[model samples]
Target chain A: MKVMVAGGAGFIGSHLIDALLAQGDDVVCVDNFFIGTRENIAHLHGNPHFKFYEQDLTDLDRMLKIFQAEQVEYVFHLAANSDIQASAQNPMIEYKNTYSTTFILLECMRLCGVKKLFFASTSAVYGEQMGVEVSEDAVALKPISYYGGAKLGSEGIISSFAYMNDMSVLVFRFPNVIGPRLTHGVIFDFVKRLKADPTHLRILGDGTQSKPYIYVMDLVDAIMRFKDVEKGITLYNVGVETQTSVTRIAEIVCEKMGLPEIPFEYTGGRGGWKGDVPVFAYNLDKIHAAGWRASMTSDEAVAKTVEMVL
Target chain B: MKVMVAGGAGFIGSHLIDALLAQGDDVVCVDNFFIGTRENIAHLHGNPHFKFYEQDLTDLDRMLKIFQAEQVEYVFHLAANSDIQASAQNPMIEYKNTYSTTFILLECMRLCGVKKLFFASTSAVYGEQMGVEVSEDAVALKPISYYGGAKLGSEGIISSFAYMNDMSVLVFRFPNVIGPRLTHGVIFDFVKRLKADPTHLRILGDGTQSKPYIYVMDLVDAIMRFKDVEKGITLYNVGVETQTSVTRIAEIVCEKMGLPEIPFEYTGGRGGWKGDVPVFAYNLDKIHAAGWRASMTSDEAVAKTVEMVL
Candidate 1:
């Protein structure tokens, strides 16, 4: 099968490309390197089944050309602006990059005769869940940040398109995915801050904000596990049952880095920043029913990610 | 209070403007005349309390300027592409007109210090309900058309903006709003078609699709009645309790026009066109609790709208 990973050179996308290539599927990695780095996919340069395109998926004409030429049977759309803080500051960027990208990709796919799509969604779409175990079907989908709004917008568009065009869509609402090739989020931020000043750590938000985290490899594996879904819109929450708080994560990072107990300074609030959802917990019953479960807890994922970044 | 009504030259907006003016509010009406017209507000030319600006609100700078210069205390955002069929055909136009316009308006509101807003949402935000009674609070909000997606997107942004910026917002999810100066919908379509060919009337769908309708004046009154809403985001389902079928609507149009039994031909299927919702029924419990109700039923609204159009 010919598959195109829209953000295939980014953190999770690059890892997904590796897994897809290992399974002997012909893969086309498309990325503009906006936040996606070239270094992440550099190791797969000479792989026979792997191809790369330095193009923005939001560019409709180019996307159309690529889809037509490749005859892409499945699209793994993961490209988006992940910076929630930046999006809250200026939402237009997120709208154009994330929402418009999905719009253009769906249009291109419809025209190019692609019938299947794997949409990478975020837990932020269920913003301010108040720490409840939110199920996939029961999501109110009120994204607090512009990033989450854009993703939710993309999901609506995808669902509509799938229903109208006789296409199959697999949507995975992910929690904080942590592992190798980590570029952003709390884990990377803590690791970088601690590297600069080992005696003390500065944490955003009151150390109370907490949520589940899925290992990157486990996330990729969950995607691989779902196949031949006969529904128009098959949605799943790909997250573990347990969560770790900011303070607990700080402790783990300090322990992983072989440092003594350090005084922690917090930027006090329920949320780290404006539009930041303080807490989120997903009901993974849907994904678990499909025979995929989180292998590691949030603590283990954060610790391993810290170690990998170091 | 000094107020700004975007899309003030459109049907519902114009009605809203009259109510505001009659109540002695200094009103500034803004519209691009896309689907709106000068004739809708021509009656207000001599009224000193009413001011009209023929400018698109999607222009961020222009919107900010208008907000600042007018010292606009309240904004009624009603501007949008009302054509769902046209939206599905060319979503880009709808995105710019409906979705992008909302984004710009909210940004301008946040920056210009406008704290209160009345947003016109829709039953389409609930998408295809399959004739289920959908309440405002229980809305899953899956808009089928680009127009619906845009409105749902606006709702998310408005809610987030209200939370982040300490603004007050009232969102009303309206059904097929019908009555005087009606520019579009099934009533207007039937009237126009029968006018062109009085011997026969052609319906778009299988004619079994049904949804509620609210008379324009009743809708305007509902907005006026909900005056002292306290909190961030106050939403309501503003439509009649019962729904009228397409076939029933056609018969009403013919009856109003005093025409003979016209041969009714259905173009066929659940929806009138691509991106058309088959069924919609909004639960008005919240609105009823607020001491407002739809005086006219769906059939009455349709017949009155047909008469008005004729």
Candidate 2:
């Protein structure tokens, strides 16, 4: 199979590229390197089957040229400005980076006669849900932040395209994915802060906000399984069933670093900052039924991420 | 008051500009003329208190320059790509025109130290609702189209800005605003089609989809009242309380045009198009308590709009 992974230089994208190559598929990795780094996909440079293109998804003509050259059969769209806090401050950047880019990719796919697309959505799309476990069928989408809004907007566009253009789409709403080579995550932030000072970790929103987490490998596996499923338009919640509080993750980071119990300070607020969702958890039965499950708990994922970052 | 009306040469913006000028407010109308026509504001060109600037809001520097030069006290943000069908087909253009432009304007307003802003939102943000009267406090927003998603995304940004900064915002989610100078609406479309072919009127859907409608003048009145109300971030559903069906609107158009009752043809679908909301009616109690009301019924508004367009 010939596959294109947009943002394939980022953490999960790079890993997905590795797996796709291992399966002997011709992979075309495209990245603008906004948040993605070249180091992430450095290992694949020597492979004969692996080709990388430095291109921005917003430029439709460039993307179209790549599609034409590769004759791409499927697309895995993982590129985005994923910082929720930054999105609150600079929403236009977020909209351009996430929503507009996704639309451009979809349009390019439609023009090139691509049959299938896999979109990397976020659990942030669930916003502040009331239930402990949010199902794909449940009404969990009411994004509080600009980042989440852009994701939801992208989902709407993808669904519209799927219905109108007969494009098969599988949207994976991943919870906080943490793993090795991650450029940004709660565990990575904690590790960086400890490495810098090793004194106190300042937590946002009282450290009580809890959310589900998924390992990067687990997310990639789920994406592959959901893609194989013959569904017209499938949206799934991809995450471990266990929930972890920010305080718990912080403690796990300290434990992994072999440091003394540091004093934790809280920024007293309902939300971490403007446009933050204080609490969220997802129901993973949809993807689990499709023969995929999370092997690591949220704490385990955080610990592993801390080890890799340190 | 000194005011800057973005997209002021467009339908609702032009009406709002007229109202602002009649109240002796200094008005600066900014437009890129994408969907806005110069003829809408050509009459006000000679007024000493009214000025016009042709500029796109997406250019932050240009928007900032205009804000500083105009000494704008209040901002009426009405610029958007208004076609829902077009947004469904071209999501990137919709996101750029609707969401990115809004963020740029907000940033420009913040830099210019503008304290108040009025955002023209749409009931399309509600998507398809089961209730007869949807309220402002609805739990979830599942917009089917890129245009609605962009509107909802802008609303999120405005709410975040209000929460973080000390900016006051009033978001008016209008329902099918129709009146004189309107470029696109059911009434306008019907009038144009009947003029071209007097015997047949083609409706998009099954002619059963109902929507709440408000005359543009009444909408302007609601907006002015909202501006006077001091609030941090207030959202209101501004529309006539009654619901009007497409079939009834066709009848009204025929009666107003003094033509024979045209054969209404149903295209057989759930909505006007793939991303259109099949039915929606808003609850205007919040706006009514704020001392504003639409004097005309939806049927009356449709009849008046047909007369004006004809």
Reference-based lDDT, each prediction: 0.83, 0.81
Q: lDDT by residue for model 2 over B1-310, one digit each (tens)? A: 8999999999999999999999999999999999999899989978999999999888988888888888888999999999776666677677678977887887787677787999988887776767646788764565667688678767766754555457788888887888888888678788889999998899988988888888889989888876854646777888887889888898898888887656888888878778777788788788788777889998888888887778
Candidate 1 predicts chain B with a TM-score of 0.96
Candidate 1's residue-wise lDDT over B1-310, tens digit each?
9999999999899999999999989999999999899999999998999998999877878877888888888889899988787777777766678877777888888888888889998877787766578876564556667777778877776767777778888888898888888877778788889888899988888999887888999999988877446658788888888989999998888888887687998889878887788777678888788778889999888877777778
For model 2, what is the error of residue A153's alpha carbon versus the real structure, in angstroms, after optimal superposition?
3.1
**Regions of candidate 1 where Cα sits further than 4 Å from its true position:** none
Cand. 1 Cα-lDDT: 0.83
Q: What is candidate 1's TM-score against the reference? A: 0.95
